[model samples]
Target: MANSTAKKNILNKIKQALDTPVPLPFELNNEAVNVFQPAKEELEIIFAEAFTKLQGKFIFCADENELHAQLQLLISSKEWMKIFCNEDQWNVLYSNTLNLESCDAAITGCEYLVARTGTIVMSAAQQSGRTVSVYAPIHICIAFTNQLVYDIKDALQFFKEKYIAIPSLITFASGPSRTADIEKTLVTGVHGPKEVYLFLVDKTA
Candidate 1:
């Protein structure tokens, strides 16, 4: 009888507490806050600096002709016999006849470039898909100036506005893959590409 009474008292107290809900301890502010100082430099310059610092190669092309010339030069210099490019548009753009199985490097297009973090945003929606970026030893991204955004929040907003439903997979790559898992020693490219290259083409210029 005493146990039953105690249980009833606890249930009644819970019900009373639920009925008279307590207010939040502090008032809530819904306004967005800027935590970091405003970036003074141009987005391209900032992105280049940050990307290079993270061991990513950055290239700027004024036009398609310049981009082709630069790509040809790089390919010749590196002597990468088979460059993997599956996208039909990219293949036609660069005049590449790619074979995936024997390619030395992979070239792909990105969704957006985050200038603040020097990150490349990619999605499975693109023809390149997920594997094309990480499967190869060297991953090269071809992006345009207009695709650049200042902050990650801006990128997320862009994604939300661009698509009715988000892609199945969205990835942000900052540079070549690196980890310090074994013996706390820093290692690069254990899980992904050893080298990452970003070719930023200036569509405005």
Candidate 2:
């Protein structure tokens, strides 16, 4: 019996790792996110405020199809070298998001966006190196409105039910990487990115 249980557990983990993402059964509503809106009126206010706080600004474009120009600023930054992406977006910003030499300051996209606490889950893969998201001085993540869920509970449920694909690794990041590890002294840019910026762009449905 013990062996059978152990085998079951192993199989469950394997299934989770190899399963394709399954679409969630629950619909996102104000009931789940409370602030969810068709116009995202309040959300726009939050976006403005939070976006202003991002340091050394960078952009992770959710729509690389040359649809949004808000990313022009980031694309033109003097420090903006190049973005690393799985696919090439030729003319949107004249960018070549490939061959990331360092994770010092790079941005990536997220699959599942949690609205409750403003968290995004990143599953490490070839395009998105495991270290690229956490090892950089600043990490920026872009997510679509439809991708956002209420919280981690809903996010995990969706993952378990849907994407059972074997993800090499999984990470749940809320804000930047921080810790009061040294004498309770608050420090930034310690273990990972001193700052984490999330951009939520909703679709016009």
Considering every candidate listed, which one attains the maximal lDDT?
Answer: 1
- For residues 39-144, write the lDDT of model 1, one tens digit per residue: 7999999999989988999999998789889988998899887788877768765535456645788999999999999999999989998898998888989999
Model 1 clashing-pair count? 0
Task: Provide the clashing-pair count of each candidate structure.
Answer: 0, 14
Where model 1 places Cα greater than 4 Å from the true spot, the runs are: 1-17, 20-22, 29-31, 93-101
Clashes of 2: 14
lDDT tens per residue, model 2, 1-205: 9999999999998899779667779865554553334424444344334444433232334454422465545446536566544423222333355445553346677767655445667776435658677765667676676676655676777767766684678787766666778999877677777777665565646
Measured against the true structure, the TM-scores of the candidates, in listed sequence, are: 0.87, 0.59
RMSD of 1: 2.4
Worst 10 residues of 1 by lDDT: 93-102
